[model samples]
Each structure stands twice: as structure tokens, then as C-alpha cells.
Target: MKITNETLATQLNHRSIRAFAKKPIAKEQLTAIYEAARHTSTSQFLQQFSILRITDEAKRKAISEIAKQDYVGGNGELLIFLADLNRNAKIRQHLGQDIARLQTADLFFQAVNDTVLAVQNALLAAESMGLGGVVLGSINNEPKKLVTVLELPQLTYPILGLQLGHPAQSPQLKPRLPLEFTVFDDKYPADFSLAEFKDYDKLVHQYYDLRDTDRRVDEFTTQIGSKKLAAHKSSRDEIMAAIQDQGLCLD
Candidate 1:
């Protein structure tokens, strides 16, 4: 496809903005972003998601502390995206339908897919409007505490935290793996080479080094290996447990 449209250009140059200006986003822009998120396609027309706008300073700060990311709360606007099945549950209850049907892994994954798609659409909308934002996964550091802080009801779980605002800094766009490493044809390739990883790692290391000369940054392979080795210590390791407690029986 030719790079002819403004929308395509905006997406092509997408970058996360952590530092935000004090100025707030205009109401019209906020409305557009929400509309974009709401219009995202859902599985089987099940709109299994909700956007929780965090306006309270105390709550935002508390959330930031939990996430261990100060920029999350200090951003001009904060939104917690949730995979919500509570509304559907309520509807089923009203209609005398079996609530156990919502307890399947399929439905749970559908909610996750719905939430992610909606948030991606919202982020794209924000970028198209010249606004900047970042998706915060750090908020899941303490899922139980986050539930208490947000008071998320049953049949709902926090999926991601999104921060949006006027841009205060313009960081360089990080490198992405080549399409061959990710995108495939009709079927998966049986064998892959490490040549691409080596090339990408060098590029990434250069990017980080140039971006922040004060500190050393590990290469891509090292970073990935480190996380892989510490998989057990991941903050979201208890996700299934939390989901079960939230009444989403994914067994």
C-alpha cells in the first residue's frame, strides 16, 4: 500500500509518550477517543469491556504507586480498561439464563481480546488527534490491591491502564522485529534462524545507547532471556487465581 493518507502516516510514526504536559485534553478529543474505542469490533457482538476514568487525584496517585510508575498518575488523563462480563451476567440473570455459561475460558479470552482491541483503537484515535499516550501494564503489579483501589466489581478485571495528554517529550520510535520474524504466510514456518535476532538486537542496543548515554541497556536477546528466566516472578502470574476470585471460572 502507498503512504498517501494522513491516518497511515500517523500510525507509521506511532510512539509512546511518557512525559505529558500539564494541559488537559479537550472534551471533544476525549469524546472522539471514547467513540473510537466503543466502535471497535467485538467477538459475537459481546462488548465485554468498560473504561474507568480515574479523575480523583488520590486514587490516581494510589494507582501509580501500585504500578510503580509515577507517570501513570501524573499524566493529564488516566483510564483503566477492564474486561467486563458483569453486564452480560446481569442480563443473563434478568432473563433467567444460566450464569455458568460465562465461566468458560473461551468467554474469558474473548473479554481480553475485546478489551485489547478497544484500547488499541482508543490509542490510535489519540495519536491521530496529535495527542500522546502510553499503555500501562505495570498496574498489574498487585492485582488484588488494584481491585481494592478501583473497586472493580465481580465479572470484571483490569486489563490495562492508558494515559493520554499533550506531549511534553518526543522520544525516538523503538525498533520492531522484521515482518519475517512475526508475520507469516498461510502456515507457520517449521524452522527459523537467529540471524534476524542478531541484527535487531544490534539496532535496539544502538537505539537505547544513543537515547540514554548515562546508563547501559541490555541487548534485545538478553532482555528477552532475562524475562523468560524470571517468568515465575511476573506480576500477573496470579491472573487466573484473581480471575477465579472475580467469579470468572476459566477451568
Candidate 2:
């Protein structure tokens, strides 16, 4: 397929990195990545998001527990992005507005979405700069602890963590489902068959992910079908409570 320069290549080759070389990142690159994040668009200019760079060794070690992965503590840079609305709410409250009565799921979603976009922009920027990283949703496991640890104020919650470093291993590009399978016109359709993936699925199924490090991993279908996505109940409950505590009314 015809494509642009590094932009398309970097995005098309996106993959998670578990092993990072023990090298540290230079200050200029770090500054560039954060600058890229700053340019990302926000929701109605509210800018309801914040980023916390974790440079303290003890803190990194503590956060790695939430991820259950040691590489997070080892990566050159570990960052936590947060969805923040409390600051704005406090300002509105000072102006005689009821913060609690004015918040809803949609507002919470907006804050989360803005934070997420900034994270993606940072990821893309890092990739462009020849730095590797992985976004971790696993940190949701200890949202309250995270808030206390980072001393985050009200109306803000950790969205996720990022691990960045030089790549210690070269993993092959894993295949994806056909684009035609997901893209649609004006009206949404759900009755379409999964027929498009017959070949693509086999290609992906044959790929042996390298993270296992010693031998071949499971086939794509087997991995997806047998994966335990339900292993995260505490995270779900706590996140819901965090948002509620932030003055958002989900119900």
C-alpha cells in the first residue's frame, strides 16, 4: 500500500514493548515529547487533563506493583496521565455553581477522552523520535492509592501509565483484521459477516509473539478467545467510585 513517510510507518508498526535497554533518555527528547502532548486538542478548551512524570525510583517501584510488570520500573521514562475536572469545578463552585449537580457521565467521558488523546499524541511523538513506549491500562487497579501517592487533587484520576525506553528486542509486526471489516458509511451495520478475516486471522494466528522470550506463544484466535478479560473487578469498582467522588454522577 502507498503511504506517507515515518508517520504511517510508525503508526502501522505500533507494538507494545516489555523489555527496554537500561539506557536513559536525554532531556531534549523528553522535552519534545511533552511539547507534542501540549499541542493536542482539548474539549471546549477546558483542558481537563494532567500529566505526572514519575522519576523517583521508589515511586516507580510502587507503580510497577499496580502494573504487575517490572519493566515499568526499568523503562527510561514512566508517565501517568490523569483526567482532571475538579480544578475547573472548584473554580465554577467559587462562582456560585453546584459542581456535583452539574456533572454527568458525558462530562466524565469528555475529561477521560481529552486525557487519552493527549496520551496518544505523546505516544506518536515518542515513536517519531525513535523512542519506544507502551501504554498500560493495568494501573487502574489502584486508582485511590495512585491519587494519594501522586497527591492528585479532587476531580482528577489516573487514566493510565506509560513505559518508555530504547527497544531491547525487535518484535515482528503483528497482522490486523481487514480494514473493510470495521469501516462503514453513514449508517451503522452489525449484520456483516466476519468473512473478511479468514485469511488475515490465519496470518495473525500463525504469529508467535516474542514476549514469551523462550518459545512460541498461542495462536491469535486462541489468545483472544481464551484470554481472561474479567480479571479486573477491583479496578472497575474503584474507577467508578473515583469518578463519583470527583463529583460526576453516573446514575
Candidate 3:
């Protein structure tokens, strides 16, 4: 038997909503969403994350261009979740404490975890209220440009972009790998086979994406083996430099 509730149902039925209605989210609802994000558990109670709600038209357009997604600037709310240690660093400095540890790889990952957790909480809150949205990792296509665009201070790095609003289109749910292939025993399984993914690949190839209804997307395994997964020369290649430029010493 399947054990579930309204929250589980909402999570299982999640679909990326690119198009949004012309209506605006109410102030109260937006506040509730923000509160949900703020209340998420952080690393050792150090809330090392900040949410930037982009309302400026020019900035939105610039972000859309950076993401290469038109819908990013079209409608709904754009919130950039940032792994932020700048505020905490300032606090430590004010108290006459050294902020050297704030730049370490450990602290950087902690902030990233805090930021990601907050994002899921905020998205669930919005979805519970009948809103839909998409997580935009494409925002990192030009990491340095994005840093410049947002004027991010030291000890802060962009983690993800979330666009939320009343959904205009209902896209079909994308398929996922079965639990047997993902969930393992206490120790890792000895080995796996490509044949295990055959059925899943067929299912994915059959599902039509709303982005391009004319033709079906590639199979999951095919996509995994494609150039899409290959490292290429792009602004994204300089992501480490960009993060270092922001004074985050990941080493």
C-alpha cells in the first residue's frame, strides 16, 4: 500500500512550469512564502543564505538573457538564492573575531546546503498555495556575468534561481529512475548493468516535453552519453575563478 498525504501528493506531482498567468501573487502569500524560506533549518543555526527578490525590469531582462530563458523575465517572481557568509562575516568582524574560517570549503558547502534547503521549503509553500515554478540552474551559464549583474559582495555566491507564480501551462511529469536503481542497502551494490535502465530510457523517450512538442527528447541514457555532459569552453568554465573572486577560498 502507498502511504501518502497532501504534501507528498504535491511533491510527487511536481512539474516545471515555464509559462505563468498574468496575475500577481498577493503580498500576504509572498510574505508567507518568504517566512517559510526563512524558517528552514540552517547549518548550526547559522543562516548562511540570502534571498534576492528581483523586481527591477532591467535586472530581470538581464537575468533572462543570462539564463537564455525568455520565461524568466516574462511573469511571476524571480528569487535568487545565494550561499551567503558576508553577513555573518560582518557580525564576526564587529565582535573583533577573525573571519578566516568563513572562506573555507567546509563553510562554503554549509552555506550551499542552507540555501538549497531554503529553496525547497519556499517552493513547497508556494505549491501548497496552488502556485507553480521552475528551478533555474541555467542562471549559472554565465556565472561571472551574473555576479556582476547582482553586485554580489564577498563571501556570497549565487546558488540557484527560482521563478514562482500562478502556472499558465500544465506540463507532463518527467520520468525518474526506479528506486531499485537508486536506493541501495547499507553498503553499495557490487555492480549494475545498462540493461537495468532500458525500460526507463524507453519511458523517457516516449514522454513529450512541452518545450518542444514537435519532437520527442532523447532517451535518458542517450542524453547522459551525449555532448551535453561533456565539459566545454564557456563562461561556466570560469565558475571557480568567479567564486574565488568573491573571496570564497574553497581550498
Please provide TM-scores, in order, for all candidate models, with all chains considered together.
0.94, 0.87, 0.96
> By the TM-score metric, which is better: model 1 or model 3?
3
Query: Which window of ten consecutive residues has the lowest lDDT sum in model 3?
Result: 208-217
Best by lDDT: 3
- Over 4 Å off in model 1, which ranges? 212-214
Candidate 2 differs from the real structure by a C-alpha RMSD in angstroms, to one decimal, of: 2.7
Question: Candidate 1, after superposition: displacement of residue 98 in Å?
Answer: 1.9
- Which order, best to worst by TM-score? 3, 1, 2
Query: How close to the true structure is residue 77 of candidate 2, measured as C-alpha lDDT?
Result: 90
Better of 1 and 3 by lDDT: 3
Worst 10 residues of 1 by lDDT: 212-221
> Each candidate: how many clashes?
0, 0, 0
Per-residue CA lDDT of model 1 for 1-251, tens digit only, reads 66578888988899989999999899999999999999999999989999999999999999999899879889589999999999999999999898786887789889999999999999999999999999998888888788889998899999999999999998888898879888998999998766658988998898888884336776888887785676377666777788888988666
Error of 3 at 105 (Å): 0.7
TM-score of 3: 0.96
C-alpha RMSD between model 1 and the true structure: 1.7
